[model samples]
Target: MKYTPVQYKVNATILIKSEKSGMLSELSAFEDLSIVKNNNKEVENEIEILKSRPLFKNVVKKLNLNYQYFAKTKFSKRLVELYDNTPIKIIFKEDSLIVDPFANFIISIHSKNDFTITEEGYDSIKNGVFGQVISTRIGSLIINPNPDYLDSFIENEIFLSIKPVMDIVEDYKSRVSIGLVHQDANVISLSLNTTVKAKAKDILNGLVEEYNIDAANDKNQIYENTASFIKERLSIINTELSDIEQGVEVFKTSHNLTNVTSETELFLERSSENKKGVLETNTQLGLVDFMNEYLKENKESLLPVNLGFSEESIIRIIAQYNETALRRDEVLKSTTLKNPIVIRLNEKLQSLKLSLKQSLDNQKKTLKIKLKDLQRQDSVMNAKIASLPKKERELRDIVRQQEIKETLYLYLLQKREETAISLAATVSSAKVIEKAYSSKNPIKPKKRIVLLAAFMAAFLIPIMILFFKDLLDVKIKDKKEIQKKLDIPIVAEIPNTNTKGNFIIAKDDRSIVAEAFRIFESNLKFLLSESNNQTKTILVTSSITGEGKSFISANLSIILADPDKKVALLGLDLRSPKILEYLNLESAKGITNYVSDKNLNLEDIIINLDNIPNLDIINSGIIPPNPIDILKSKRLQELFVKLKSQYDYIIIDTPPINLVADPLLLADYVDLCIYVVRLGYSDRELLSVPENLYKNKRFSNISILLNDVNINSKKYYGSPYGYGYSKPKSWWKF
Candidate 1:
């Protein structure tokens, strides 16, 4: 058999996981597996080929495996670790290498506090040490601990106890460590030996008077206390002086002294001269100096010289007075506005204002010229307007026309409002449902359709299945198909059995084959009785050879030959005659020989099977080369007529209609032609030939005998005994 590739659609319901619900949802769609050739071949073979291929089978297996995995592990732990920054690792059994550095780092820093150092104090110095070290060690392998890491280490043993000690050392080094120093050799000599002794004596007198201590009592204690206090005060003064000196050094460093101009050097010279005079005067000198310079010069002596103030007190008073005078002088100087840069700027600003006033006057003259020109244009426009008609009759006409248009527009607007109101109130003229819920029985799969489908499949699947089962089993399975194609009716159906007995009439009536003969007999009686003229010559034929047409004829003749009527079974298949062998009769003289010889009569070749009373058989004595031409001859018609008169019913088994034209030629001479159609053995497409014959009025009587129908096959229909057919164990096995 030849096969053609055909596209077949298959539908399946598959369960897919829902992304939102994380559960299975049913999905259904048709899929085109592939195009396949199906020329009477087994469907199981195609399924097996599809299942064996790696592409489809692997996909199916992977889907099933994934589903099973999901069932076992509902949550993907790997996915959680990926997004949540959780510390986790898949450790190889052999070696414990850290696979993920980022995860490990997160785990290490999870509990560490974010620390900040104070701007002033030991904390700052400690931070500075680490900062400097980190700056130096960057781009190198050394791990200078960051604030968080250091805090973590400090909280643990060994590092925690040493942290405070390290902080103190770092603070000390930062405060006192000076790496280098330079000295300047310049010096100023001062006549300060006698002055220092006088200042010390004066300070001692003030301490004795202030505390009311006797000058003679505990001199050492007073000296010691005075010296200690003075030394402490001097130390504080020295530190302050050192900070001032450092500021001067910073200024000198920022502005190089070597780069100073002559004018800057002169300014520094004047400042130094003023400082020298102040130092030479000894601002803390005695009251004698003050009185000599002030009261003594005026010759005004105090009332009691003994009550006069001490030299230090007088110097302190004079210093306070000088400080007040100096502060007053500074205030006077700022208010007097004698600064050279400010005076110069004021003078230049005054000169600029005078020049700007002169320039503004000149520009005013130019602006007046342009203003006069604009005034002239304004006058021209006024003169032109004055020259036009004062009443403007055309303007009045336009105004009158606009008023009329406005009135007409208002009228139209009112009409539109009326139309809109009418539309709103109008009834809606449309159909509305009166009875909404008219109930109806749901139409689903029809039982009649299912049963008919089962019957048709039962009739056809076996024949198709048998054709694919083996290549050489050529047999007819349906009688109606043969009748329709050959333009005839079914005479009988013969059951297949392994008995090798003489052709016997079914009188005992207990066998299945005998029951089938009865059915044929009943159909024949109905067919003949309904006709205007009884059909005596019935020709049984098939589409092709080996369709059991001869078997049907012989058995049908036996069933029809009752004690009341005569029946003759004629073997007219001249190409191959198996009737003589079937009946155990010798093919000595038969229809073929009688047709060839002009003097031969039907009586010379007729034989009777003893098992069937009133049943006679005419077997083909010899094979003929031109069976069609012999069947078309006038002698065959005369032979059929003679047998029609002698027999109540003559069943003639002819050759296959599709293989030869003998059946068609013989169909014209027979009273009724019975076509034998084998069910499983017949092709569905071949049924069209018989259908077309009937549609074209080839013969009047026609019926189908479905044969070889397998009632127990699921491919056909469910078994009558309800024994469920099991799926082929290796349905998809290749």
Candidate 2:
């Protein structure tokens, strides 16, 4: 099919210049246009993109064209165009032009703190930068009928949408390239190409007028907005200042604290006087205490010597008493106690002592009298200090608040003046360096560049999609999936083995695979503690087949029998029997034979392994017709009861619960039910099946076991279960 080529014949160029700016406006808008954001929904020049997309849509509608078809044709390179065709170009001070419509443009505006230009600021300058060119819409096209149109443009109607009679081309915003006039100039040049010269001239004239008017209006709006914001802040500050002043006045009146400083000085003076009185009283009390203590010793004659007495009369009396005492001691050393001279000296010494004691008691009475007076004075002064006024504290607090509010009010008034000055000094961020003019030659149809881009995208898209598709797989890759999806406890994790046989446990080698079975056995004992006192019957099943349930059961039986306990491995999967094949035992006479023939005893169907000590196996005799019915037999319960008395541990391997009713039917006969889930193989959604069964009490003791886990995986690096006890990897080869 052949279609008319869409190309522009007329071309026009317009210049947007920033007047006194650091080129912040031009740079920011340029960045927004150049940068392509998340999913192409967001752009750097948000304001221009928003206005341009809608403006172009309106233009296409008026011209009566299909927007979807037109956009698709240009994007896919279905309609070939020229290489020299450019859209809008934003030039910086260095003549740097931003012409890429698919890049994210960012402009750095440095302030004391870096100033980030917001989306709103970008919106305001869009029209000033792009100018007011009329938009056309595809719906108005004569060839296509639009249901959204209010009324069709009939032959007699206004005929608002007319097909270009002069073969005029509809140029898109992307095709109208922008560039710099010179390399080292801040001159931005916008160019659009069309098919008609008159249309291009009219569009350029409209753009010049629109750019100037829009730029001037945007500058005025910014001034008005800034003034309004400052005025609002000033009003709030004034209201708060008034409220604070009122509060200060109310507090002063309530507390009766007018002169805060003077009252505080007066109270402080009273406190000082009280402190002096207390000091004097304490001194007097200390003297009285010393005198009382001296009297207690009954050494009144030596009072002047011990206490450093200054009174002359007391000193004279003490000297007389000491003289008499010395004379009596000298006579008593030479004569008998009945001698007249010694007796006379003793009587004199007694006389002096009585006189000294009376004088000293009189001195003590005088000191006690003085101490009581001082104590009374101290008490009165302390009471006065304690009662010092609280009005001073309350008044000081009120005055501090008043001072703060007054300071803030003055600051706000100063800020308001500065804001008013700023409002008056408002200027536009945009400056039109040149008026819009049309070019002599047409510019459109960048055919070569468009074709190259299409080719690159065609080569890379499929490869990228395929790479990401693999990363989005939802299959369970580890034990984390089972843990995240289910609420049940994970009892154990068995590592994936490269052993040749199904029963991967080795008794001779202490490898990781052998140790994993031992860990499973220990976890089983904990799970079976309540129900498995003598012979614990553990039923192992899974969400689906091929989850390693039988492998776990066989190894676990071997580990249990290692402790010199009687262990029995029972194969209860009637639909598919693989335990016998793994054990290389005859499955022709086992559980099925015992169930069919009631007369058969437990020993008739049981197979004891000659190589393993105390280990026995009861394989599924044959694939039964009715597996669920066979599981529900009374003989099966009787057989388990007999096995419980005979063996210490019984491990029962059952069919997958999701596939058959056999496991759920035999769940009652077992002490514990172990649900096996394979890592990296099973679906994450299937874990809910085991969780539901555990919740509804279908199995009394139910726990999940993770199988086929990578031992080197991160699961062992964390948590409550360290699981780091596995043997070395070298043992597997040996």
Error of 1 at 330 (Å): 87
Candidate 1 lDDT by residue in tens digits, 225-344: 323432443354356545555655565566443343455345436544433332222221222333334333322111111112323333333333332322233233324547664455
**What CA RMSD would you report for each candidate?**
41.4, 39.6
Deviating ranges (above 4 Å) for candidate 1: 1-505, 532-535, 711-734
lDDT of 2 by residue, 1-734 (tens): 12435445443333333322423333444343221111111112222422243334444434323211111132453433211121112222212322211211221222222212112223321112122221112111112222232122121111111233122223444555545566555444555565444444444444444444443443444335434543554576568668777877887778765554554466547655544444443333433344345446544223222122334455566556554554454345436789997778777767766666566566656655665675576556545545556665555445545554455455445544544443444433234454445554334445566678788888888877877865676557876667677788888887778567665465764666666677777777777776636778788999888899888888888878865689999999888887888777765688988898888888888888878878988978867788777788898888888888889888999889998888888867777888988887777778778988988989888888888878676766422234354445576663
Give me the candidate number with maximum TM-score.
2
**lDDT of predicted model 1:** 0.44
- Model 2 residue runs over 4 Å out of place are 1-472, 714-734
Superposition-based RMSD of candidate 2 using all C-alpha atoms, in angstroms? 39.6
Listed in order, each prediction's TM-score against the native is: 0.33, 0.37
